[model samples]
Target: MSPTTLPDGATLRTARPGDEPGILHLIHALAVYEREPDAVENTTDALTRSLFGPDPQVFTHIVERGGEIVGIAMWFVTYSTWTGRHGIWLEDLFVDEAQRGRGYGRALIAALAALCVERDYSRLEWTVLDWNAPSIAFYRSLGAIPMDEWTTQRLTGTELETLAATADGGGRDV
Candidate 1:
């Protein structure tokens, strides 16, 4: 889709294949905000491959102010078997340091919410770190609630690889 210009001299638009560098730059900004810059495992090539390659597994939207990318939001569709419909899981949202107070963050999220409503998505979800007070407040202002009953868990390193390589313990390394 073509970019949509906002009245405030900014634009909101879907990401394109040519936006790899800009997206990666914002990804780095997000990682830094999360206090783990070195944990970003994605490079521009990796982002381009994952976002715009043959499979096109993810979607991103960007906010540009005065010709510079000021914010970004990346999301993907997920199925909620219990709900039996598709929902949007926002994987990352970030506004550049210098642009934080300019309403770019809210505009990015509002655009995403607008899309969710337009597409009839069953839900729109994202997680904020517990210590991120600013983000938590922002989310609360948007009427988002904490999924208190759910605890997120994940397996990584050896455990993940082992599970991937093994079956239900029949001949799989008991």
Candidate 2:
């Protein structure tokens, strides 16, 4: 996709080799905004490996203004058995608090939607904190509907380890 020029001369484009630090910063900011400031354990090295490494499965798009990254949309592909196609799972979307209301957030999401359309992806999806009213309203304004019938579930830490220990191959590497 071509780089997009934002209202204030900011450029929205895909993340590149030297973008890890900036992307990681936005990730930490996102964690803080989600009221989980201490939850982020991401490092630039990990991001570099995941986003720039050979066979990278994850991707990120960022907004840069005056050479500083001000927004990000980090995502990965997911397969839906029902649809028989791959879709984008937006893991994070964030714009600097000072840059909010400047259309950066919308631009980031719109870019993902454009990518979905371009690649014939079936969906672009993400979860928002239930109490984040402003974000909920923004998403709704963009015609996003909630999958209210579905409940997200997870098994982490000790539970995840316990479950893995029960695998048929005794959790041997595939």
lDDT of 2 by residue, 1-174 (tens): 778898789999999999999998889899889999999888999999999898899999999999999999999999889989889999999999988998999999999999989989999999998999999999999999999888899999999989888786656554
Clashing pairs in 2: none
lDDT of each: 0.86, 0.92
lDDT: worst 10-residue window of model 1: 165-174
Please, what are the lDDT tens digits per residue for candidate 1 over residues 71-141?
89999988889878788899999998887777777877888888878877788898889999999999999
> Which ten residues in a row are the worst by lDDT in model 2?
165-174
For residue 103, give model 2's deviation from the true position in Å: 0.6
Q: Against the hidden reference, what TM-scores do the models get?
A: 0.91, 0.94
Report the C-alpha displacement of residue 81, candidate 2, in angstroms.
Answer: 1.3
Task: Output the lDDT of residue 80, model 1.
Answer: 88
Candidate 2: deviation at residue 26, Å?
1.1
Cα distance off (Å), candidate 2, residue 64: 0.4
